[model samples]
Target: MFDNVKNNDTQVSELVASICRLASCMEGRGDAAQREETLHETLRLTYKLEEALNQRNERIAYLDRLAMTDSLTGLLNRRGFQAELQRVLASARRFKETGILAYIDLDDFKQINDTFGHACGDEVLCHIARVMERMTRGMDYVARLGGDEFAILLVRSQWQDGERCIEKIAHEINSTTLRWQEHLLSLKASFGIQTYDHNSSTTNLISAADDAMYLTKKLKRDKCTLSAAE
Candidate 1:
């Protein structure tokens, strides 16, 4: 009887040991599954972060383009053009070459705005911008300098080529017709051309070009008044 009771107690102890070993195996499997789930979540978050960074970079590029470009005409704005001009001038000095600057003012543009309407004036300006862009080379710089004024920077060009370019630009401006609200609007531009010297600073070159443009405007006005009197 004693031996039988001892044998029964031994069997019970073996059974309890087997149950504990099985429980420990299940707990280890559960821990491994939780670790795998955490790893997947971390990978998903990393992917989302990468996508956000790419989108932000694209937005920054778009804004930079907008800042450099004019909203209405799609040409370079004054600031952008000036920066380009400076760069060109620096290159020209390094190469010992000449560049040309043309100052263009739309003749009687304010009258068009006042008589026709602001909308018509805007159309005219856009038309002129397109014409200038079409006439100039890809390397050239064209910009609107506020209101009815525009400027062009021609690099590595001579005086005669500059004159020819301005003449062509003037012809295009004179021939362009803007039709708005059944009204045909004609336009003209007075230009001042100056050749840049290596010795002259950018500001001085711009001033010289501005003076020449004013002189041209004055001459054109005088001629028109004289013709009217005749």
Candidate 2:
């Protein structure tokens, strides 16, 4: 909204400047040669203003992209993802559609950081991000929700299909290995999925997904413990 106001101010200023220049040219009507020169100067200034406005628009667009994107993985950041989700919700309200939101957390990301510095950890995250992009459909949205957290939105998908898609994504990510220097790094993540419709809010859905992910992680831990006992 502030950007809109700023842009409007710039446009108004340009229009006023152009009007003033034309008025100055009309005021010197007695001097034909001077008026022609002023007319040409005004036309030149108008062209310059147009170019400046175009450049300003391009700059704004670039900044907007930078603001929404995660620098490390080149995926949408949390803010960007929220904006996209809200847009999806608006569409859901209008069309009575449904979608899936999955929250993912790396199981042992801190261990990797503790063992092999932050730089290696960063690279591993990037690799995982790439794997996620490869596994999902073009219509789905992928985002890095800070730290070791990521999210995917299955837009307008059937409930059963969305569940299956998320399950495949989790498996693909778990099985993938990254060769970093002398060590081969494998990452595993816990995922929680929740379906959203016109009635869903962003905060509630994310919170629910997070709870589900934690429960999934607990089940995995319990299974590991039982297997070890055997």
Candidate 3:
């Protein structure tokens, strides 16, 4: 919003400068016969300038959106995610509301990239992101925190509600399959959830959720190793 306002102000300043220049030209070389032509020229220039500024503003807005979004999955990027986390935390604290923060990581995502290639890996990520969006409430926030990792914020929801939602999302993601070219790929994810605590700082909350997710991943790996040994 601030950027839009600033850009608009700049456009207005530019227009004013152009008008001043036109006024100077008219004053210095005025001819009663050509006065009408000069006024028409000024109007044409003004319209052109307005059209150019509008296009520039539209481009600026598109670039800003791209900056905030992950190009691969169309989810919020880390910068956008962090900004939203701060906002959600502030609001939760102010209203003494309960919410949940979840850190999610795709299981064996690197292996997929190595085996099938980057294109398939990207498809899987987008699939997971889309599934998450479909499973969560409209008010919830989901973001991609870099390669194969994502975060979710369940605003104004209780611990139980968040737990259930996460379980459903994780289940759906695991069950879903992606068909890339002639190959079929199954997906799975590990999730770590941290319920909102009024006293917890944003850093602590994020750390807790990340730790939980790491633990979950480790346990899964251990189980697989043990089963293979047997």
Candidate 4:
């Protein structure tokens, strides 16, 4: 990897040197015909060099984005999400500000995969990601923590604001109807919100939120069961 980067850098330097040499040749007091020919060749070389540079830069950018993004949902994967969370946590600690971390798990996602197919399940995950992206603020970070789990890092938000945001996210996810082929699939998500405190560790914060989410899921299921029994 290091060798590849070094080689690319060397190639760029060589191209730049070639351009400079061509410019100097153009400035020489030589035969008019020779100078004219050099000018045409220089122009062609310059265009090709510029094109090469653009392609190289674009490829580097695409690779960087892929490194940080989840292939399935186009959201930050676990590694990327953890990095961003650490940055946010550090900032919150330094500034003595508060933030919210929401852990979201899709309800009955496995059932979707079992009944429909993995492709359909994949579409549902993408739909949920889109809904979270649409509902959250620009500064808020949304990430896929693999499978049907996701995390939202809400910066500079109060506890009440966090609650409201989670509620809105849950509502939007539950309300969405994704039509795949002939089947219309509806989804619901359970989320746990935890505020970042001065003493909060990343591991504890995430675990706490996850536990809260599971509790909520259990309560919801128990309520349904009780209602059915009644």
Candidate 5:
């Protein structure tokens, strides 16, 4: 990886060196033919320089994607999600739309790991990631915010619609099952949702949704406790 980066740097340096030599030739006192040759060289070097710069830019963009993408599930990492959230907020302000943020925490994920092992845990996360990817539109941002936690953003949506959308998503997630080896593992997640307009800040919005998710999880736990008692 470092070698590839260095090679890109070297290509850029070589193109720049060629451009500098052409500049020196144009600056020196010379005859018309010599000056014409130098001018042609400069013009050719200009295109090469532009091409080199384009390649460098492409490499930078690729690196950025690598930095922002989660390795496990191919979803956006936390940093990427926050950056995307900022963009969605800006877009909402400009277009006068509302954005929805849903924070999801997988229920009893640790126990699943303790019983079935880490490989099974990984399968569960990947399976859930696929379900989320399937459920969302291409434009929507969905990220696994590390370790049984995921976030979803719905742009240009109304509060009621966003609420309903998350309800459906939660149902889909909670009802799903992943068959790993000999066992069929039940998957469940608790979701906390918040609606944001231009007035909302990313930090506060995330915190709000996270808090809501905790509340949802607690309520679900309490309901289960009550049912067991009854």
Candidate 6:
């Protein structure tokens, strides 16, 4: 009976050892699986963060462009135009090249607005802006200086080139047709051209261009008044 009891105790100890070993194996596998799942989750989160950052950067770039552009005519706004003019002037001073500036004013724009409403007037301005763009080169800077007033900067050009640009723009504006509802509207622009002098400041150059534009307007007015009298 004693020997039988000792044999039973030995068998029980071996069974307990086997069960402990199995439990250890299962715990090790579970730990490895948990580690792999954690790594995958971390990688997924990292990818999402990078994607969000890229989208934010793209939106910022788009907003910057919109800020520099005019909403009405898709032309450069006054601020952007002024910056370009300053840059060109600085370059001309350094390189000793001739630059030309032209100030453009739409004739009878207010009358158009009064007759056909602001919406039609806006369409006319957009049409003129598109025409001006076609007439000028890629290197030239053209901008709408608020309300039917526009300007062009021609870099490294002679008087002949300036005259050619003016003729092209004027002709195109006069020829372009704006269809507003049932009516077709025609428009004209008066241009003032000034050649930059290396000795002059940017302000002086701009002033000269403005003065020239007024002179052109004055001449047109005089001619119209005389024709009316006749």
Q: Estimate each model's TM-score.
A: 0.76, 0.88, 0.81, 0.76, 0.90, 0.75
Q: Each model's C-alpha lDDT?
A: 0.81, 0.88, 0.87, 0.87, 0.90, 0.80
- The reply for model 3, stretches above 4 Å from the true place, is 1-14, 22-52
lDDT of 3 by residue, 22-136 (tens): 8778877758757777777789878877886787678778878888999988889999888888888888778887899999999989999999999888888888899888888
Instruction: Give me candidate 3's TM-score against the actual structure.
Output: 0.81
Candidate ranking under TM-score, highest first, comes to 5, 2, 3, 4, 1, 6
Positional deviation of 222 in candidate 3, in angstroms? 1.7
Q: How good is model 4 by TM-score? A: 0.76
Off-target runs (Cα >4 Å) in candidate 2 are: 1-22
Tens-place lDDT digits, model 2, residues 88-122: 98999899999999999998999999999899999
Using lDDT as the measure, which candidate wins?
5
Candidate 3 residue 96 Cα shift, in angstroms, is 1.8
- Each model's RMSD to truth, in Å? 19.4, 3.6, 4.4, 4.7, 2.0, 19.4
lDDT of 1 by residue, 1-230 (tens): 34544554555455455545555555566577765765565455456545545555566667677787888898888888888888888887787878789999999999999998888899998999989999998888999978988999887888899789988998888887778898888888888988985665789888999999999999988998999999
The residue-by-residue lDDT of candidate 4 on 32-131, one tens digit each, is 9888887887788788778767767876877777888999999999988988888888887888878889999999999999999999999899888888
The full ranking of all candidates by lDDT, starting with the best, is: 5, 2, 3, 4, 1, 6
* Candidate 5 per-residue C-alpha lDDT over 106-157 given as tens digits, one digit per residue, 9 for 90 to 100: 9999999999999999999998899888888888899999999999998878
Once fitted onto the true fold, the runs of candidate 1 whose alpha carbons sit more than 4 angstroms away are 1-48, 228-230
Where is the poorest 10-residue window by lDDT in model 4? 1-10
* Backbone N/Cα/C clashes per model: 0, 0, 0, 0, 0, 0
State the lDDT at 80 in candidate 2.
93
For candidate 1, what is the lDDT?
A: 0.81
